[model samples]
Target: MTTESAAYTADIEAIAQVVAAVEHSQQHKDPDEFLALFHPEAVWTTAGGKVLIGLDAISAFTREVLPAADWDGKVTYEVVHVFFIRPDVAAVKVRQRYLSPGAESEGAPLYVMSRQADGRWLLTACQNTAVATA
Candidate 1:
């Protein structure tokens, strides 16, 4: 589990569940559900380029934005890649699709997740970037 290969091979499904939860929370506009996926000192950068540090800031942002989001419960998140920094840490790339019919868009989010003592993965740091049309 110390080598990169072992780390990469470990917990792929478990880490994916974290991303899946994000999709679900986003689709449902459930701030609490989204907040539960973060580490206590997690950092998140929104697609709009706002930087939020710690759970408090992340929580505040999510509470306000998620509830007011106009996605209309149509969205999906897929883990496209995962690179292990350690046995308990991974850098995950995700494709986030805003499935709002005619106005569909996509986001490429990179999440640095860490496994907790209880073996649960939480998002430790992340940057969400919008995929602009050419």
Candidate 2:
């Protein structure tokens, strides 16, 4: 592979790690860790349509919901797609699932991540949409 291609692949892998960290923090119910993945001015919209602007708002919402989540099993987030808007910005599509005893539910989340000057990716904007079934 060309050096440029190899570097691009490395960037994508690093972004995936950041996304996976979100799932890890949520599954472990550590709001601080989850919050750390976002930028200070990040925006998050929940599956239920609540819009949280900025890290403080996001922190408040996550702290309330993550810990009180009633699922018995665990939650997972998988990166389904990643589109690079620029060398420093990407749009990521994620499949989120909650697994419980004899039941499962899912959401599709879109995360807009930005690469910081230090080469770390942080979520800047996100929206979680519930997968509806008839």
Candidate 3:
């Protein structure tokens, strides 16, 4: 493989790790860890349609809801696609699933991540949509 290809793969892997951390934080209800993955000026639109602008708003919403979420099992997030808008920006499509004793549901979330000057990726904008069944 070319050096460029290798570097790109490494970058994607790093981004995947960040995404995994997001899943971890949510499943474990650790708001601090989840909030740390977002940029200070990030925006998030929840699955229920509440728009949170900036880290403070996001943190408030997450802290208030995540811990009180009434899921009997765990939540899992998987990266389904990754589109690079630029060398420093990416649009990630994620499949999120909640599994419990006798129920399951899913959501599709699009997360826009930006690579910081320090080479770490932080989520900058995101939208979570519930997967409706027909």
Candidate 4:
């Protein structure tokens, strides 16, 4: 494999680790873990249509909601697709699933992540949309 290809694979692995962290944070109801993935100026839109801009606002919202959230079952997030806009930037498509004995629902969240100078990927901009049944 070419050096460039190897680097690309490594980046995808790093990005997938970030996505896995998102899933981990959600399942554990750890808002701090979730918030730690974002950039300081990150922007996020929730499935419920609330838009939060910047780390402070996102932190405020997550802290208020995540811990208070009640879930009967488990949640999982998968990185379905990754589109690299540049060497240091990636647009990631994630499949989010909420599974329970009573019902199952899904969310499609698009997360834009950036690679920092320190070689860690952080969520930059994101939107979460619920899948609707017709």
Each candidate: RMSD: 2.5, 1.0, 0.9, 0.9
Better by lDDT, candidate 4 or 1: 4
Alpha-carbon deviation at 50 in model 4, angstroms: 0.7
Q: Give a tens-digit lDDT track for model 3, residues 1-37.
A: 9998997997799789988999999888889999999
Q: For candidate 1, which ten residues in a row score worst on lDDT?
A: 1-10
> Per-residue lDDT for 40-79 in model 2, tens only?
9999999999999999999999999888888853999999
RMSD after Cα superposition, model 4: 0.9
Candidate 2: segments with Cα more than 4 A from true spot? none
Cα RMSD for candidate 3?
Answer: 0.9
Instruction: Determine the backbone clash count of candidate 2.
Output: 0
Model 2 gets an lDDT of 0.92
- C-alpha lDDT score of every prediction, in listed order: 0.93, 0.92, 0.93, 0.95
Error of 2 at 102 (Å): 2.2
Q: Write the per-residue lDDT of candidate 4 for residues 51-112, one digit (tens) a residue.
A: 99999999999999998876753999999999999999999999999988878899999999
TM-score of each: 0.93, 0.96, 0.96, 0.97
After the best TM-score superposition of candidate 3, give how far the Cα of residue 121 lies from its true spot, in angstroms: 0.5
- The lDDT leader among the candidates is 4
Per-residue lDDT for 108 in model 4?
97
